[model samples]
Target: MSLYTFAKNLVAVILFPVFRIKIIGKENIPKEGPVIICSNHTSNFDPPVVGITSPRDIYFMAKGELFEKRFLGKLLLKIHAFPVKRGMKDRNALRRGLEILEEGYTLGLFPEGTRSKTGELGRPLAGAGFFALRSKATIVPCAIIGPYQPGKRLKVVYGKPMDMEKLRNSKASAQEAADAIMEEIKFLKENHSP
Candidate 1:
């Protein structure tokens, strides 16, 4: 197995005992093809939580700053993460994500751009929606809750894959599509079974 697959499975194995993860709607994810997994950013643990929960291999858009650490950067790259400049529309990073999608790989993204210190979903960025519309990839809305507390159950709910027909035609604005996706994520989180 590749380093990415090994690391992902390793992380999952490590978390399984410490965190009681109650996952819902896992079948919503596609069995094959390129997909965009979009979720809220609440903590550093969010990435690993989402990564471990999903059965498929997911390539993440890690912050460019993380790549500055040589050893950590190489490790991140090996685990299917590519660095992206934060707070701006980085075209090169976007192109790379699209290329991964074109190759039929799953891409994980946070539409909020950064972690929410306030524990609330921040303003959704347009990048995820833009890529979803451009690539015509299925968008999977995911909600993660209660991560970073090893004793508590960390919950993740994956909503049904959104076809985004209105979005596919470019008739809907990117911001509009993003808003819709974020709303769905919010819905799943609030309604998730305890």
Candidate 2:
């Protein structure tokens, strides 16, 4: 296994039982090749929550501020997380994401940009759609539900790959594509609510 995969798996194994994570639709994840695993933002724990449950290495975009703590930042980098400045368009982060996709690796992106403290689905930013269009990669819509409480199962449902043909052909705005993806995620969230 790759070093990042090993580290992620190691951490996942340790936390799985502790968090009582119960993941569904894991098979929906493409076994290989470049793909974007788009998910909803809930709590600060969402990244690790989804990461630990994934069977493959899924690199995530963490905020640059998290990397400010030299020691913590180094550790995060080792585990396959690169920094992205929240709000402003960070070209460096976008470049790194593209590079990861070009290398045939999976990337995890939260369309909402930041965690939603309200637990409701929020507006999605266009970055995920932009990345998909730029890389010509498949977009896997995912919904994460339930509280990440100890002994309480945390659920994640992976939707089928989104149809990009419409977005590819028409003059549909990036935000429109993102909203459509978010709508699918919302449907999954409602259908799979615990």
Candidate 3:
């Protein structure tokens, strides 16, 4: 099995029961082709949960701090994650993300740029929208609902792909496209039921 698959399964075995993760609307994910998964960030577990539930392998851009350790950095790289210097524009990270999509792979992003401490959706950075427009990849907006208490339910809802062509045709700014994606995530979070 691939490192990504092995790591994902291991994480699922360890964390899924603890969190009681419930995934909804997974059928919305396309079986193939380039795709961008954008979602709100709250807890540290958000990325792993999304990765575990997603049917496709997702390449993620994680903060540079996580890779400060030599061993962990190597492991993360082996499992399809790269580090981005947060609070500054990192051209290399952005270029790598586009390359992943150009290769018809899935890329995951949290466009808020950082986690929201209050559990509320925040404004998104333009990177998500930029990726969609530049790579012509399908954008899937996801909402992760969680208090993250052990044994409490944590849910991930995947919305349908955003209309990228419409956004492109209308000449939407990168920030505008990101805003549209977040609005969908907010809708999913508010309307999702147990």
Top candidate by TM-score: 3
Write the number of the candidate with greater TM-score, choosing between 2 and 3: 3
Question: Which window of 10 residues has the lowest lDDT sum in candidate 2?
Answer: 2-11
Query: Which model is ahead, 1 or 2, in terms of TM-score?
Result: 1
TM-score of 2: 0.93
lDDT winner = 3
Tens digits of per-residue lDDT for model 1, 75-188: 999988999998778998999999999999899989998899987888899888788777868899999877567778888889999879967676887888888889988888
> Residue-wise lDDT of candidate 2 within 1-194, one digit each (tens)?
87677777787777788777777888888888888889999888788777877776788999899999999999889888999998798999999999999999989999999889889988999988778777867788889888868887778888888888887788677788888889889988999996
lDDT (CA) for every model shown? 0.87, 0.85, 0.91
lDDT of 1: 0.87
Instruction: Give each prediction's root-mean-square deviation over alpha carbons.
Output: 1.4, 1.6, 1.1
For all predicted structures, in order, the TM-scores are 0.94, 0.93, 0.96
lDDT of 2 at 37: 88
Worst 10 residues of 1 by lDDT: 166-175
The candidate, 1 or 3, that scores higher on TM-score is 3
Q: Show where candidate 3 strays beyond 4 Å.
A: none
lDDT of 3 by residue, 115-138 (tens): 999998889999888897888788
